[model samples]
Target: MLLNDRVCVITGAASARGIGKATARLFATYGARIAVLDLDAGQAEEAARDIGPGHIGLACNVTDRAACDRAAEEIVARLGRIDVLVNNAGITQPLKIMEIAPENYDAVTDVNLRGTLYMSQAVIPGMRGQGSGAIVCMSSVSAQRGGGIFGGPHYSAAKGGVLGLAKAMARELGPDGIRVNSVTPGLIQTDITGGKLTPELKVEIAKGIPLGRLGVADDVAKACLFLASDLSAYITGAVIDVNGGMLI
Candidate 1:
């Protein structure tokens, strides 16, 4: 129960198979009250129900600063204070640089990069005032290795921005006792991958990892838990690779 009696807010938690949902569940299991924020109101509420009573759900579009601010306010109103924030809302567009449309590039950047900024901005004041908090951004191995199997140039650029944002925030917020970090997950099986992965594709991906397997949502969630806990109190501006030695 590293997070006992804490309150954690997870964005993009509506998808049952997403890293955000897994992180929310793990946080709740560790005795933290969760605020599950997603674009879909019903799904968010349903996730909240599954997490048990006292947890809450709110509908928010993180790209909109006002909406993010409102969601933060609502969570504080219900949960008292926020101790952790996991910026896990993201989307991927699997197209070559030449094939990517301007709209698609903007959309990916808006959610992956801008959304992270808005959510962090909305939550930082409370964290600073409390003199302690943790912020985890959902970066990707794509940012490091340029989308080996998951996305394209646009996705890579957007995720790279997340890494930069996390590091900058960590520096600015460390004096206030707020830790900021990013987790770069490799190829993880999720609904975002679209249905089930093909046998050949899976095999090809597995061959590239030293661990010889694709990652699961729990792998990233567990890394997030470590960053959120007091065990990482002295850590900030760090990028934890949950990529199973793929980058190494």
Candidate 2:
């Protein structure tokens, strides 16, 4: 158990088929106490129950700094100290730039970019006080290759910002024994994409990937666990690609 006895906080963990939920489950399996944060209080609580005891669920609007701070405080109160922070709360809007609405763009940026910043900021104090911690931000292959398959321009831009933020935070926090990194996943099959992908579209995407398949939530979660563990102690400001050779 690489994360044995550690406490990990994962945002956007309520959805049954979300990457955040998979990451939370993986962290729990590795013996970490989890704090599952999501916008839906009931769903978050249900997720916590599914993960079994010794875990907690909290309602948090990651876009709101005050709410994020409160959630972090609540987690600390229950779990003692936070050892890992995963900024995984995000959303996507699939529309062409010309057709995209201002509200859609704002919504995507608010959750994907601003939300990541708020969550990271809220947890930095606790991690700094502990003298050691890891932070993982969820970027996307769309950020690197410009959203050929997944999200719209705004979504790609926001995810790109997440990568940049992770790198900057890594440099600033490294001396304090806190490491920051980002993971970019490619064409992952989650509830977010299920509604958008037709049978023909899924086949088209699979053919483009060298691995011959779309990515699963576990693929990203495994990469996250690696970054969260001491195995990555010397690594910071690094972007791990969990894209199954889609970008290569």
Candidate 3:
């Protein structure tokens, strides 16, 4: 019960096997009244119901500033205050550097980077009001390694920007009692990447990882839990790599 009665809002949390949803489920077990946010209202609400009563789901297009603002307002009005904000709404595309078009760049960067900015903006006021909060941004190993199996150059650039944003926000918000951090996960078996990685491919990828297996959603979720909870009370402006030693 590390997060007992905490009001946590997580974006892009409705997916069946996504890291966001995994985090939501794990957080709920620890006594958080969760706000599961997604682009689809029905899915978001359903995801909340699956967690149990008292928690709620919200429809939020992280790319839309107005939508993000509205969602934040409703959560505050209903849930009372925002204690944790997980900027997890993101998308990736596979394309080479030359293959990246203006629209491709916009689609990837807008969700991964712009959405992070907007959602954090939407919650900072409440966190400031409470004089305490935790904001966890979802970056990727792709950002650190310069390329990934699925993400294009644009994706790497977007996530790298996320790291910079989180560090800057952590510095600016530390005095306000807000801690900001980033989680960079490697080859997690989620809905987003599952469709692309075949059994044979997964085995091949696992061989490179020192853990001898590909990462699961919960691996990243556990890292997020540490960052979100008091376990990391003094930790901020940092990046936790849940890459199973892929980088090393």
Candidate 4:
């Protein structure tokens, strides 16, 4: 077990078909105690229960600093220590530049960028004390290629900020033995894309992808498992691409 006896927290993990939930299940299977944090308290707890025993679920709005702090403290109090954190809580909107109102931009950027910062801030103190930890922030291919099928300019901007933020955090946190990294995932078949794409559109998209298929939630989850585990111990300040050659 790569994460034997470790405690892990994943944000926005309540959705049944989301990447965060997949990551929680994978980590649990690897012997890690998982905590599923989401905006809905009931859903969070339910998701945790679904994952298995000895895991927890909590309500956390990551854009709120106090909420992030409280959730972090609660997890530590319940689980003993936090060895890994996956900042997977995020939201996106598909709007053109002109369609991006202040509210839309705020909704997208606050959840994706501000949430990542707040959650990381909340976890760093505990990690510093332990002198060993890992944080994986979820960026998007939209950030790299400038736009995506579903995310707008604002979403791309937010994820671009994630890449930079993770790198900077990795540099500063390395001295404390806390590794930080980002994962840039391409178009994955999740609730979001499922709602946005037709079967015919998905086929067309797959043709454009070198792997000839859209990524699945498990594909991104496994990449995150690598970064959170000792297999990538020497890696930090790096961005792992889970795009299945779409960007190459």
2 or 4, which is superior by TM-score?
Answer: 4
**Which digits, one per residue and each the tens of the lDDT, describe model 2 over residues 31-105?**
999999999899998999899899999999999999999999999899999999999999987788997788998
Task: Give the alpha carbon lDDT tens digit for every residue of 10-49 in model 3.
Answer: 9999998999999999999999999999999999999999
> What is the per-residue lDDT of model 4 for residues 147-241, given as tens digits with 9 covering 90 to 100?
99999999999999999999999999999999999999999988877788899998999999999999999999999999999999999999999
List residue ranges in candidate 2 displaced over 4 A: none
Cα lDDT for residue 64, candidate 4: 98
lDDT of 4: 0.96
Worst 10 residues of 1 by lDDT: 192-201
Q: What does the lDDT read for residue 143 in candidate 2?
A: 95
lDDT of each: 0.92, 0.93, 0.96, 0.96
Show model 3 residue runs off by greater than 4 Å: none
Task: For residues 16-50, write the lDDT of model 1, one tens digit per residue.
Answer: 98899999999889989999999989999999998
Against the true structure, candidate 1 reaches a TM-score of: 0.98
